[model samples]
Target: MTVTSARFGYDDLRGLITRVVDVKHAPEDSTLDVLWTLYDRVLDLSPERLDSPDRDRFYLSKGHNPGSFYAVLAAKGYLPDAWLDEAFTAGSRLGGHPDRTLVPGAEISSGSLGHGLPLAVGTALGLRAQGLLKPRIYVLLGDAELDEGTNHEAMAYAGATGLDNITVVVVDNGSASHGWPGGIASRFTAQGWSASEVDGRDHDAIEAGLRGHHGTGPHAVVAFATSSI
Candidate 1:
């Protein structure tokens, strides 16, 4: 059964994170703030209109660590709070990687790196083809995942095609083995994308970064999780 409660809020996210203890990485420290901000302020999505064609789509590319993702979904009443307790257990819908078919609010079944961004691009194109222009697409990925050539190719294609309906959030915890020379934002800017860097932990800064871009092409937000895991 679905559980929606007015009592769920930002403060309750931590408790929900603790319930899912099987995650291999502590990505919650870096991603929780941004996840909360997106669900709370940026994305035009909710539990009620999850299947609506006009609803915004958020693809979690960095799916290896989904504690914060699930927490924000529950906090925003997208899924039952009891499901968090059963995460990664036998028969539980919540798995190590999010499955779109199983999870109520997940837009894509993501776990493999370098796939979500491309999939999001394809989805945006599909939406445009269907004349569903009101919806926006958001994809969140780890900095380390940028090492994949497919991501760069996808960024170039999105930028070249002027896919303005898509936005990419890169959570940078300094995890990239071979870092970008001019910074992560430069990688996108070079490919004609509007890019910006912000303090990942600052909600206001993150909100601004997410909404600051007004380019005709896609936008990228490099959220530096300097003080986080």
Candidate 2:
């Protein structure tokens, strides 16, 4: 049986990392742990749903934070917690970036931004071909990742394909340095895609954005967040 997360809030999950970091006497990467909890709960609480062929798929396009992702996967039982301590410690499957083959639940080896969305198009198309229309495909992107030209290509493709079974979660931390281009939301709309902005730090808002869609075409969820990790 798979272990499910207890619907803990982000703050609660962050607190867990604070305690764990203190116990392990390793404070350097504790913030990463908090981020991992999101994946942990996502995988756990929604395991059965996710595992099903008709269930939704999550493509973690932002792979720079694989450490936190691995740690959470471990906590959720997909990986070994020992890997957390030994993480990036040499000769470990857990590296700075996710290797889909090595990480059981990871959908892609995503160090490069803008790649997952395009690939997600293929997955979404494949699933549609298979007649699995109930579940959608979600791609998680970091704010800085928008710099990749491929993302723009993907946005255009999604618009052209009219893929209603696709959604993108933009984890914007406002630290992307260059910041997202102005009129991003409008741009997506002009391309025949639906777009919305939300507070990334607000769990409720995030959940709402993910749940409600126009069923017209692809959707882009821009989440504005400020993460210390």
Candidate 3:
């Protein structure tokens, strides 16, 4: 039977991810609370409608490591709970990086840097073209991932075109090799996107940031969350 992550608390969920993933990583820890909040409270998604035409989409654009993504999928009933334990084992479908073909509910295959945002823009545009504006497209990227030129072009286009259905959640733990000047949210704001910075671990704050931009163009949430592993 599929069990919802809501049945368990933060500590239990965190521990489950750690035990399944085995190794500690900052991006995972920094993004854990936000991911939990999105899957458990914000995103209109579930295991039942993985192939539905009108379902919302989530893209893990920062594809370097996806331990939290995998764990959240397990906790949210998108996959078998037993699969989490087999993550990274030989022949296991779960790997350090997510593959859309192998992972159900994975919107983007997301192998290289700076691909998710552009692809997400296309998805949002296509959805709108199909008159499916009710669905939301969310892309999760890292502070470091923003350095890629591909993301810059994508964000600029989304903001300029007013893709209000797109929401970007940037897990900012200050890991960028060359940090963004004048803060991370400023980048989104300058591009005409509604942007907010909040504590990543604060579920309430994260939820607010994720949902506060109703008609304000493309939205972005900069989660200055914990940097520890």
Q: How much lDDT does candidate 3 score?
A: 0.83
lDDT of 2 at 206: 66
Query: Once superposed on the true structure, which residue ranges of model 3 sit more than 4 Å away at CA?
Result: 1-9
Clashes, model 1: 0
Best candidate (score: lDDT): 1
- By summed lDDT, the worst window of 10 consecutive residues in model 2 runs over 25-34
Worst 10 residues of 1 by lDDT: 20-29
Model 1: runs farther than 4 Å from truth? 1-7, 22-25, 226-229
Q: lDDT tens string, model 1, 1-229?
A: 3557443888888888888763435667698888888999999997888878999999999898788898888888888878889999889999999999898889999898999999999999999999998888989999999998899889999989999999999999998998877799988988889988999999999999888768588999999885343
Query: What are the TM-scores, per candidate, against the unseen true structure?
Result: 0.94, 0.79, 0.93
Each prediction's Cα lDDT score?
A: 0.88, 0.66, 0.83
Could you tell which candidate, 1 or 2, scores higher by TM-score?
1
For candidate 3, write residues 15-71 as lDDT tens digits.
667756655565577778888889988888888877776988889898776777777
* Candidate 2 clashing pairs, residues 3+ apart or interchain: none
93 in model 2: Cα distance from truth in Å? Answer: 2.2
Supply the TM-score for candidate 3.
0.93
